[model samples]
Target: MSKRDYYEVLGVSRTASDEELKKAYRRCAMKHHPDRNAGDATSEAAFKECKEAYEVLSDASKRRMYDQHGHAAFEHGMGGGAGGGAGYADMGDIFGDMFGNIFGGGGRGPRRGADIGYVMELSLEEAVRGVEKQIEIPTLDECDSCDGSGSADGKLETCGTCNGRGQVRFQRGIFSMQQGCPHCGGRGQTIENPCGKCHGQGRVEDTKSLQVKIPAGVDNGDRIRLTGEGEAGPAGSPPGDLYVEVRVREHEIFQREGDDLHCEVPIRLTQAALGAAIRVPTLGGEVELKIPAETQAGKVFRLRDKGVQSVRSRRPGDLYCRVVMETPVNLTSEQRELLQQLEATFTGEDARRHSPRSSTFMDGVKGFWDRMTSS
Candidate 1:
């Protein structure tokens, strides 16, 4: 019988991108994996078929050949049998490409430690002015007992399974494939006696306290990276980086937008009407804000260079203070009498001139009454 089309097996079009092909193959493989299916031969066969299809379709040169001349293009030196069979070298390349990310691949060299993130919560004031803080980070560090050798005797021996090749070949029908050795876990070396401390892992969990200097004007969600501060790699590889993400707590008095600071300042009705000088709090210090006569509620006052400084530019931002006029309450008899007299005097003036909004609303009410009585 003729072999099925590679795209048909993976359920992808020939024109699919490498990412799309990989996604389709991953979905199918995860669904039909032998471990997931557990003794289902049909699912295992389907999983292998999908893997083979992805191995060919994911590669540019192989895909081009298969598209141009079908499976016959690999019959000569490409190591395919009469009806499309892949060799051990091809399978090794596929496995390397797939598991390389998981195993950390830099040309089959030493693996680096995994990068980690540490979240640091800061108050609004701390974020604006910056502060030095000490953080405890739990990470994997090199074991000091066995000197990170992962062996009881601080010595390593060649793997007996793959014989230092790191991979083992297996024949499947007419195709041959190579997979990472389970014995050595692709390290190509074996520890005869595991390290008593780290159990041959070469790294141990430890909490390290590090002092971090937060830069001025770092906003919420900003990240600072410290190189070589993350977990140590196995044996002698380079350590990964540690990312410090900043989270600014909400402030009760101020709200930050970009580099600008916004705050609501409540002033008495007398202060809004007759005008008064008030002290407003800023990041730098307290500043006097002059409220002009007839200052209405919701009036915004700008204080230049009183906001947070920019992390990149180092220049300061402005602070905006919005005035909220508060109504006076708990008036004594004398105060009530004085307010009543003032209200009478103001009412004596032309209604349009004294209170335009009140005059307009009264006229509308009168018009509505007239219409209702007439109807």
Candidate 2:
């Protein structure tokens, strides 16, 4: 019987992408696998057929040859297969060549090192105005003994098991499979005598001191990146970066919102009732604030340009100071007598003129009492 078309056997169109072809082949292979369909010869045969179809159609050069000249391209040693026949061995070699690279095999070259992060705590003052700090970090550095070669005396030899191919192939029932060589660990080369310093790992753990410059106006959770400061990768790979994360500490007296500073200043009751000039603390130093007469408690006073200057802008923020009037306690006997006399003098005057709120409250109380008596 004549063979079926490879694309038809894999159930994919001629224009199928590589990913789509792989998905279709994986689905068909899993569905009709001989291991899954035990005692079913037809399903096992179909599985092998699907594997064969995928082996040819998944390759660009093989698929082109099969499309133009059919299977005859491989009949007379014309194509790159043993005896010019599309056998399982040839198929396994092709699959291994392509999929091995995808799966981190066949000496897939050096990989970049992993990036690391460190949380740096900063005071509110330091965060507002940038500061420089030195920190110590523990990381992996390239071994200096053999120059990261993992070989003593800087000597290496080809793997004997895989003949320097980094992989080994074996025949199964109706298919062939390729796997990484067990002896060489897929490196294709082996150290005759391993380095004593890194123990053949090609990297060592060491602590490094780094100076980090934090920019002003950086808020909490901000990240500063230092290029090529992270751990070194294996042997020939490139080093990674180091990331510094900022965490601002809480202030004792001030609360910051964006670029502004807010604080509460306590004032005596007399300072609120009779005007006075009070001293207020700012980032620049102490400044005098004038409180007007009859100023109520919980009043906010804004001091312009007394807050923080943003890193990105020339204009500075304002400082808001909220006044909290404090009541006197533990009064002396003479002070108590003076307060009593003041209260008596306030009652003798017209209550409406002296205390408008008290006068209005007393009038309401009198009206309620008159209504109750009449009822």
Best by TM-score: 1
RMSD for all candidates, in order, please. Answer: 10.1, 14.9
Candidate 1 lDDT tens digits, 1-375:
677899999888778987788679768977986657878989978987886676567645457657976765444322222223343557646565665443322233235766778999999999988899999998888888887778889789987766676555544344453444434545678898988777676777789899999999999889999999998876545788999999998999999999999999999977887899999998878889999987878999999999899999999999999999777899999999998887877754564676776778988999999999999
The 0-to-1 C-alpha lDDT of every candidate, in the order given, reads: 0.76, 0.74
Q: Write model 2 residue lDDT over 276-336, tens digit each, in one string.
A: 9999999888999999998878999999988878766846889999999887899999998
TM-score of model 2 vs. true structure: 0.58
